[model samples]
Target: MASAVFVLAPLPLGSVDLAWVCIWTAVLSASLLTARVDHGCKADLWFMVPILAAIAAIAVIVWIQVAPNILANLQDPAWGNARDLAGIDVPGRISLTRSSPLLSFGYYLVFVLGLSRAYLLGIDGWQAHKLLKLVAYASVCYALYGILSQLLLPDTLLWRQKEFYLEYATGTFVNRNTAATFWGSGGLILLIMMVRSILHKSDDADSARVRFLDRPATQAVGCGICLVAVGMTGSRAGILITVLSMVCAIVLYLAPLNRGGWLLWTSVRNSLVAGIIVLALVGSLAMGRISQIGLVDGQRYEVYKTVLDMIRGHTVLGFGAGNFDAAFPPFRPASLGSQGIWDRVHSTPLELVLDLGLPAATAVFAVAVFFFASLITAALRRKRDRHIPVIAAGAFFLGSLHSFVDFSLQIPGFGLLFACVLGCGLAQSISTSTRGLARRAPDWDSPILR
Candidate 1:
């Protein structure tokens, strides 16, 4: 249900915002009505503290950006210039607009709510498996729709005209890069399922090998279709990052070779060979597109340089949250060309620094590092469900790497999807033993317990 609302709404701006309303409502309702607080799982949720703190810090900065200079040191020289021209005192602070950051808080809520909702449901191993499978199926459905639409419609999204990216398969998104990340995430999930079956980690390892081979390879073909959709997007970095992330996931799956005997060795060899074949064939799908654009986007590279300079000037307290569109005009270098309206920095970190300042961006980065470390810890600790945490970590890496060059994760739906996946996996990965339990629960009624 959560996946469909995000994946199907390709034309966004208003549509994306609406999707958030529905998602937040459903997640919140489910959380309030049915979500339980298991002592063990609640303890594990402490990992989200840094993330919440980062959000709060940005919120405070946004408030300060809008506060009166006399009160919060947010005076803008632009207001002075306006006052002199108008012959009347004009008051203004940092942010160009009041609503942008306040509206941006919605995106932040998506991250928090997505993870919270998923973590709540993921406490049960059964539900976690179901969640993973649901995402995988939805991805395949979207991938097939994109491939068919590119072939059949060619110029329309639903009933409306595409107007741009006519030749590229964008799935349900407006941008091909975002589509690539979306499908690539799906492709990665499919690959994880394949690896799990191949590893023969099922309780009945003896029969797992035969059952895996005997089963129809629908997911293999599904992965191919997903790759085809990704390739059709013609996003060079998207293709490269997706394939690299898949390789990393494969390596993580193969890490426990010591426990394997002759049977597992054969499975590993077959899995590796298949991985090589898939990489070469699917990678070739994007080769033509890569050749056309080469490695660097010249125009985009200049924009990145300008954004970097802007960040340097506003290192302490940035212009304002979601104020990049207003903050960028003065700093726009001539080399970037004055042809387009520049709002997004195309890089998440640069934009965050531009909006909330460097310290806040660092806090966000630290939160990510902490989560990655937790995932690694889980992978190392768990014997049975190791793939869950490892795949979650790999998924985060995929989105993070892509965010460096493109803003896929900035898209509310895509970011929320990853958050939910991470939340679900982390819920399962954490020890969840009696560690999160209170030591004094047994003595609650006794005076000594107090």
Candidate 2:
């Protein structure tokens, strides 16, 4: 799954009518068929939640809006892209969700299920490690590409487009920032996996014959490559989030929650060492040209201002999804004249609420809180294995923090990666005896000993 994400991320699907979606449609059909045959298999049910919810939500919203005018429009409904569906349109035929809806309802369904499959099938760790390896390898490859790009075909890359001068080392991606976001997520994931392995002394082995995550030294080297690649991407948001995640992990290490003794001390020590390694690798490019970092900082601040103005203008329902640029042109303060169209608000939650309405935004937020809360609880439960909660909390926290500055979730590739992590965390929790769902409680204070 990780390799698939990494490989496909750099490529553009262009229109919503792309053929790749059909593969998922096939998967969904097969899952249903399998369920019918297997009756009560948990594996089949795992991937259905997000897809089912998205379908249900879209269906309800469409029905509610068109029920009044269904009879009138039944002959020839007003068909159009999803953006039209969300706007203040009259009741009519429900938009075909398969079309480019706000969240690409069909895509999200697949994302949720894929993650769920990783968790239930117990391949989460293996897949994560595999993903890390791909990042490491890709980073190494990108490093070589960066050198070549600087020396040779400096002006020819298509993704570079007109932003050639401003472009940082984007590797295979069209935009430097997008490349950075990709490698940044990869670096952080690699670090988390390595740290977990070293601290817990657990083997990352599984039935799958992947020799990738089992060896410690190889994993560390891969992480080094990824760290370098991420830095080269020159993404402020990615760097910020990576640093924040490390800081959180360090604080967790210092706490005596695990053993409160020498083992705790060792963990903290290891955590510090790991943090230093990450910093050294990521900060290498900035060592000589620290001033450039400052320039990037200013650009980020300007972007933030733009995002704020956008929010202020559309507080009730922010710019519609995929309509950031369309909405921004009018709302943008004249002070930043002709700032150009922006595909993203660079902030996920704000963008989500702005585009999908407050109710939809609230639902997304609830899902995040639920997952994070569960992860934190799992981490503190002492008896539970330390690595699972630690990875989940660290990854989720890091990604969430990063989202404040950039819309990682909006990117199909990163969004899918995140869903996988979330699914793994949820699966781990379920696997543990402490089921999160409400069950009949044992009669409290009804002890026979009393």
lDDT against true structure, model 2: 0.51
Q: In angstroms, how far off is 399's CA in candidate 1?
A: 0.4
Q: Using lDDT as the measure, which candidate wins?
A: 1
What are the per-residue Cα lDDT tens digits for candidate 2 across 375-400?
67655543333344555577678678
lDDT against the true structure, each candidate: 0.70, 0.51
Error at 383, model 2, angstroms? 5.9
Off by over 4 Å in 1: 1-15, 18-33, 39-42, 70-74, 87-90, 204-216, 258-276, 432-450
Tens digit per residue, CA lDDT, model 1, 96-118: 66567767766776667667667
What TM-score does model 2 achieve against the real structure? 0.69
